[model samples]
Each structure stands twice: as C-alpha cells, then as structure tokens.
Target chain A: MFEKLDPLLHSQLRLAVMSLLVGVKEAEFNYIKEKTGATAGNLSVQLNKLKDADYISITKEIVGSYPRTTCKVLPKGRKAFSEYVNALSSYIHPNGNE
Target chain B: MNDAQKQLEMIHEMMNKSQREFQSASFYYLFWGWLVFISALVHYLLLTQTNFTHPYAVWATMPIAGIISGIYAAKQQKSSKVKTYIDEAIGSLWLIVAFAFFGLIAMAPALGIDKVYPFLILLYGIGTATTGKITGFKLLYISGLLTFPLAVASAYMNFDNQLLVLALAIFISYIIPGHLLKKKELQMANSDA
Candidate 1:
C-alpha cells in the first residue's frame, strides 16, 4: 500500500508551483510566474491555497520601492512532497527498484 | 480517473513540467557560455588585427559582463523546477572568479602570458565540472575532464594567440555540457510524462 498524496498540491498549477519550490530554497513571485507561465491572478490563488495548508511560507517585502513576494517550501511541504513521490513511484515500478 | 488515480496523474504531470523547465534552462546557459567565449574571441581578434588597446576591452569588461549576465540568469532561475540554472551559475561563477584571480597573479611573474591562458582554460573547465556536480550532470564532468589536455597544450602557444584556448575550452566544457544536461533533463521530463 502507498501513502496518500496531498490534495492541496494535486491541482496542476499548485503542484507545478510546489514542484519548482521543492528543488529551490525560495522563489520570488516573478520567478514562479515566468517558469510556470501562470498568470499572476491564478498563481496568487494557488499559492494562497498552499499557504493555507502550511506547506509553504510566504514573505512579503519591498525591493527598490516594488513589493517582492518570496515563497519558501516548509518542512511539512518537503516531507509531504517526498512521501507523495514515493507513493507514486510504487504505481510506476510496482516494486521498489532502487 | 478515480481520486487516487487523479492525484497520481497530477503529481506525474508536475514532475514532467519541472523536467522540461530544467532542460530549457540547461540549454539557455550553454548558449550564454558560448556567446561569452565567442564575444571574447572577437575582442581578442580585434585587438590583434587592429591598433587598439582599450585595456578594459578584453581583460575587464568581457568577464564582468559574463558574470553579470550569469547572475541575472541565476536570479531568474529561482522559479525553475530543479534549480539547475542557479546552481550551475553559482558554481561557474565561483570557479571563474577564482581562476581569474590566480591567472592575474600568475601573469606578473613572467610566468609568461602564455602559461596564464591555460589557467583561464582550466578555470572554465573546472567551472563546468562544478556546475555538473551540483546538477548531477554527467556530461559537464566529462567536458571538464576532456579540456584538461587541451588547456595544457595551449600553454605552448604565443600569448597573443592564447585566446583560442579560451574559445576551445568553452566549446568543450560549458557549451557541450550545457547542451548535454538539457538533453538529459528533457528526456527525464518526457519519461515522467
């Protein structure tokens, strides 16, 4: 049996954001937007959803008079994402190959 | 798809998306590396061909511009799925700066301007290797290793002609490795899909 994947990150956009965040320490708003090709409105909504789950932490500040929002993957997010990958791998490989 | 299946599919999709982004980033950096080398070569050639001695032209400005562009790329790469760009850029910059420092110091000893070129070549090669290590890119390491003999051989060339060594190093190291990493990343992404 496999562990369940988190529902919050199951959505395409949210999952994309989290997936990108997983490999990084933190990402700025524009950085996420450019990579995912997600509109600001949509990304903002998806990020808020992740924040609600406590999977990611968002910090807002001003850089040269412009607001900068940076998102970081929390410990919970890392654990959940790892478990999710493991659970999914079982489906593809059927057995632990590695 | 059932809820479980749907979630699994979603996860898979995300993984694939991330892979694609990584692939693109690898190629992007590779292109920039080539551009930097080629531009420097042009500068060197112009200096040799014509009567121009803008001290900052080949020596100071080129590498500084390359480093600045690299930093920008890394900052923008913050959103990339695998963080490959930022890692590569950081590693490359670290090695490049170190090499430049040593190369500058070595230039003064009449160690011959010729000997210094090999150091520059090695710096770029090591930079590629470090980038590869950070990103788990096998090709980068291969490129780094391949450049070793070429860098050594270039030591025998005249100082004026040594910039060719820099060009060759970039082609073998950063350019090829960058492309290889991108290819691997794309394959991985497609596999996930």
Candidate 2:
C-alpha cells in the first residue's frame, strides 16, 4: 500500500502541505506553515523536496513591499495525491485480513 | 530490501498511522456544503407545502438563504481553485432557488402583474448563463437558453396552468441539470479509479 503512494507526498508534514495546497488554488508560505505547525526550517526543507520532485510549484514575489512565497499544487500533484489517498485507504481497512 | 528501502517503508507506515489526524479547509467546506444542501431541501419542502396559501410566505427566506449560500461559495472558492463540476451545479441550483423565492414573493402581491414570475425566470436564465461561463458548464448555458424565451412567453400570455409552467421550468432548467452534473462528477471519479 505504501509502495503505491508517491514518495514525495509520503511524509506527514509534506503530505499535509500538499493536501491543503491541492484544495487551494494557491497558498502562502505562512499559511502552509501555520496549518502544519512546522518550524520554518522544517517547512523549507519539505518544500524544497516537493519542488525537486516537481509536485508543487513555488513562486516568490513581493507583496506590499515584503517578500512572499506562494505554493500551488500542479496537476501531477493532484493525481498523485488522489492516488496516495486511494492507496492509503487500503492500509486503513485491510482486505483479506478479516 | 536495503536499509534505505526499509527506512522508507517505516516512514510510510508512520505517515499512515498519523493520517487520521490531518485536518484542513477542504474538509470543512465540503462538510458545510453537504449540511446546507440537506437543510435547504428540508426547508424548501416544508415551506412550499405547509406554509400559507400565498407564495409570499416563503419569499422571506429567499434572500437569507441566498446570502448564506453566497458566503459558502466564497469560502469554498478560497480553498479549491480548480473548478469542479460539483461546485458549478451547486452554485446554479442556489441561484435558481434564490430566484424562485423572489418570484413567489412577487407573484403573491395580487397587483395584476403575472409577469413577475416570468421576470424571475428570466433572471434565473441569466444566472445560469453567467454560472456556465464562469464554471465552463455547457449544460448550464443550454438550460438557460431553453428557459429564457419560455419565461418571456409566459409573461405575455395569461395561461391557466401558469403555476405548472413555472414548476416545469424549475424542474427542467435547474433540478435536472443539477442531477446530471452530479452524475457526471461521480462517473469521472469512478473512471479515475
């Protein structure tokens, strides 16, 4: 079941971030950080991982004279998330065990 | 499996173990929409059947419900950028119900203006067109085109079955299309699996 899940989205925090991002058209860095309750360093590391996998696109721009980083899940990310969810459900309620 | 493979499997296990704890906006928005759908259906049924003889009785709830649905839509849009078929149908249905509420209110005035309901239907038609454009729902535009002219004609001629006509328009233009969109979504999800 775990093998079928996307390795990029297999982590708890990163999975949470991508799940939230998929629903939202785009989310701010702080939004993801606040929602996941992860420290800036940890969030940055996970975001870089996702960026490397091409699962999420991150854009840095200035908003109100301040730097902002926003994240959006790509179509591939959405498909991976859905597949991850479907595969995960099999583990939760195992088949042929009962 | 190598040590790295074993570590990856363990991490997957740990993630799955904690998956039950994840919470986010998408869950809440969908949960609220489902609640609204159920409650609104009950409200409509009771108001239409048990309320006073005049249609104005239910009109009071129209604006209130419309505002509520609008707020819900705005909240949902914030979370989900992708235009899913589900939201499109729900939004169209919301507008139709809102317009119907106003139509009933206007029709009850006894001001000898039977055109009020027809005008409301026309408003619903426009709403469908706009929703279709925004959500890329071709069926919505088709439904709008079918209802607009019929609404206009109903206003010009005083027919004995005016109530039946209005009911048919709502059933065909809104209710049927709403169900079809829902079915389409379900089919897509199934095929995806």
Q: Write the per-residue lDDT of candidate 1 for residues B1-193, one digit (tens) a residue.
A: 2544565666566555444343244754576577767766886777688877662255555566667766866666543434444555665576566668566656756875666667777776776666666556677778877788878888778765667777777878877777776777778769756
Docking class of 1: incorrect
Alpha-carbon deviation at B124 in model 1, angstroms: 2.0
Q: What is the CAPRI rating of model 2's predicted complex? A: incorrect
Steric overlap count per candidate: 0, 0
| Interface CA RMSD of each prediction in angstroms | 4.5, 8.5
lDDT tens digits, residue span A17-86, model 1 = 8877876656778878877789999999999988988899998976557788989889998888887767
The 10-residue segment with the lowest total lDDT in model 2 chain B: B20-29
User: Which residue pairs does candidate 1 place in steric collision?
Assistant: none
Best by DockQ: 1
lDDT per residue (tens digit) for residues B63-123 in model 2: 5755775676676555432433335454556557566755665575675546465776676
Off by over 4 Å in 1: A1-17, A28-46, A62-66, A87-98, B22-110, B129-146, B158-164, B167-193
Please estimate how well model 2 matches the true structure, expressed as its whole-model Cα lDDT. Answer: 0.60
